[model samples]
Target: SLDLANGPSLEGIAILNIPSIYGGTNLWGDNPSQKKRRKAQKTKKDKDREFSNSSMSSAELAIAVQNVGDSMIEVVGLENIFHVGQVYAGLRASGKRLAQCSQVVIRTRKRV
Candidate 1:
C-alpha cells in the first residue's frame, strides 16, 4: 500500500508519452459519429494508426492523464477507477444531472 504522508518523490521524474488516437467514449457521452466509428472499428483503427504515426504530435492530455492516473491508483483504490461516461450514465440513471453529481464530488474533494 502507498503511504499518503510519504508520497513518491518526483524531484527528477520525467515521463514521456507518445500521442495515439483516442478510441474511448467521450467524457459527456457517445454520439452517432462515435457509434458509427466504433461499429467499423477495424477500418477506424487502421486510419487511426496511420494518423497517429504521421500527424499526431501532441501528448498534453495523454501525458497528464497517465501521470495523474498512475500516481493516484493507490490513493483512489484499485477497484474505484471508472470512465466518466460510466459515471455520467450512473448519475443520469439516478435522475440527477452530471453537473449536480459533480457538485457532490467538488464538495467531497473540498473536505478531503
Candidate 2:
C-alpha cells in the first residue's frame, strides 16, 4: 500500500503495514547526472562499500515496510519518473524473492 500524501488523518484510509514510496516528480532537488558522475568516480572498494551501506536486504526490507508502512511517503513531481521506476523495481524484486522462497518452503514441506 503506497501513498502519495502524508498525514495522520489518513491513518484509517491507509494500511500502515505497507510502506509508502514517494518522490517529487518536479526534480527540483534531484541531480541524477551528478550522482552518476560521483558514482563513476568511486573506486571498486568505494562502490562496494556504498552499495553495502545503501542496499536493503530482504529482512531489512520487511522490517522497513513494517515499521514505516503507511508513514513512508515520497513527494516527487511528474518529471521524477526515475524515482517511481526504482520503487517499482524494488517492489517487483521483493515480490519475486518472496514468491521464490515460498515455493521452496512448500516443496520442502511436501517432501517431508
Candidate 3:
C-alpha cells in the first residue's frame, strides 16, 4: 500500500495544488485500472519512508528534497513555489545521478 500517512507533509508551505490524480475523488481516474494496479505495486516500497507522527519540520526535510525525484523537479508545497529557482538547488543537493532519477515528478498540495 502507498501509505500517504508516511509521505512528506506540506504543512508550512503555501500549497498551490495537489494533483487531482492523487486526490480521493479522482483515484485511478487518469489511468486504466490495470496500469494503476501495477503502479500501486511499484510504489509500495515507498510506504516505508512515509512520515511518522514525529516527522521533522520543513527545515529538517530540506535535506530530503534532494532525494525527491529521479531527474524531474517535483516540489510539493506552496512555499516551495516561491523558491522555484531552487529546484536546481534541490537537484544539485541530491547529487544523485540525474540519469537515475530522470522521471522526477513533483506534486503540490492544492492551493487554498
TM-score of 3: 0.21
Tens digits of lDDT, candidate 3, 3-111 = 2334543233221122221222221012235555566556553343333333333222322223322343323432243233333334322211111112333344676
Among the numbered candidates, top lDDT falls to 3
Note the Cα lDDT for every prediction shown.
Answer: 0.24, 0.27, 0.30
lDDT of 3: 0.30
Per-candidate count of clashing residue pairs (backbone under 3 Å) = 0, 11, 14
Candidate 1 accuracy as lDDT: 0.24
For every candidate in turn, the CA RMSD to the true structure comes to: 16.6, 15.8, 14.4
lDDT of 2 by residue, 1-112 (tens): 2221321121112112223433322211222354554554452223222112333332333222222334442222232344445445553221211100111111222555
Per residue, candidate 1 scores C-alpha lDDT tens digits across 4-88 of: 2233222221112211112432232222354454555534443322112332222211111222223221011111223333444
Please provide TM-scores, in order, for all candidate models, with all chains considered together.
0.16, 0.17, 0.21
